[model samples]
Target: MMIKQVFAILAVFLLFVFPSASLKNLTYQETDKVALNVSASDPDKDAFSIRYGSPLDGNGQWQTAYGDAGVYRLNITVSDGDLSDSEEVRLIINRKEEPPMVTSLKPSTDALSVTEGRMLSFSIAATDLNKDAPRLCLVPGRPERFWGEGFFLRSRLR
Candidate 1:
């Protein structure tokens, strides 16, 4: 009967001395640097071994890329030989926005004068570093007669 009581007490003690792990979800933009360190606690001060189930360097650093915009599941485990704890963290990567750049504008000068009932020609070129499509449109409330052929703009003044 005494041995049974001692065993019960030891069970409760072991339960209170177990190790635990904690981690939080993270969010970042593309091309941003990421660094994360696992968090764990052990009452017995035991040495812990950490394992990452995702693509993280030894120092828990990752350099995000342009095409890496999405949600990632990070599985981390902390173990002290006999006991182990694990945590699942979500890492979100967002795409960065960049404005389109005008590469060239025909009739280099900003303004030009054309006689009435005459034809005028111009062109505009632009590029987007993010591989997005570039659009060209006339300003609203402008009194002009023009048609676009790709990036080329041809106009006739009445």
Candidate 2:
């Protein structure tokens, strides 16, 4: 009985002295070039295994993409057979800002010539690398004569 009491006290002391596994939350942008490295540590010098949910590669890294902007809950756990620790990591992925590119302008010339009572038409093409819809609009407070025939043009690129 005395030996049992001594072992019990030793176990309690070990619990107070040794620390468990720990992890921290992360936030990243979808356009970030760097990879997200999920790291955890155990101070007991025990062989442990880490378990994290999807979107993480084999090396426990994540390379974000354009459409990956969202909040994720990762249940990360580390276990050393007898003792284990778990953490609910909140990961926030922010959207990347990208501007649209004008691909081409029809009538590809600095000047346009038109005759009286003749109809004139031109077009503009644009694209967005982020897969966002593109919108075309003339600058506000422009001269009404620039838009002859009271026509306004707007186009969306797929």
Prediction 2 global C-alpha lDDT: 0.55
lDDT of each: 0.58, 0.55
Per-residue lDDT over 21-78 for candidate 1, one digit per residue giving the tens place of the 0 to 100 score: 2234566777777666556665666677777667667656678776678878876677
- Candidate 2, residues 1-158, lDDT tens digits: the string is 22111110001111111212223446667754323344444454556666556666544456667868887776655666665566666567777867777788887764455788888777888887667889887543335324433444444444
lDDT of 1 at 66: 61
TM-score of predicted structure 2: 0.55
**TM-score of every model versus the real structure:** 0.50, 0.55
Which runs in model 2 stand beyond 4 Å of their true positions? 1-24, 33-46, 80-84, 110-123, 138-158
Worst 10 residues of 2 by lDDT: 4-13
- In Å, residue 64's CA in model 1 sits off its true spot by 0.8
Error of 2 at 131 (Å): 3.1
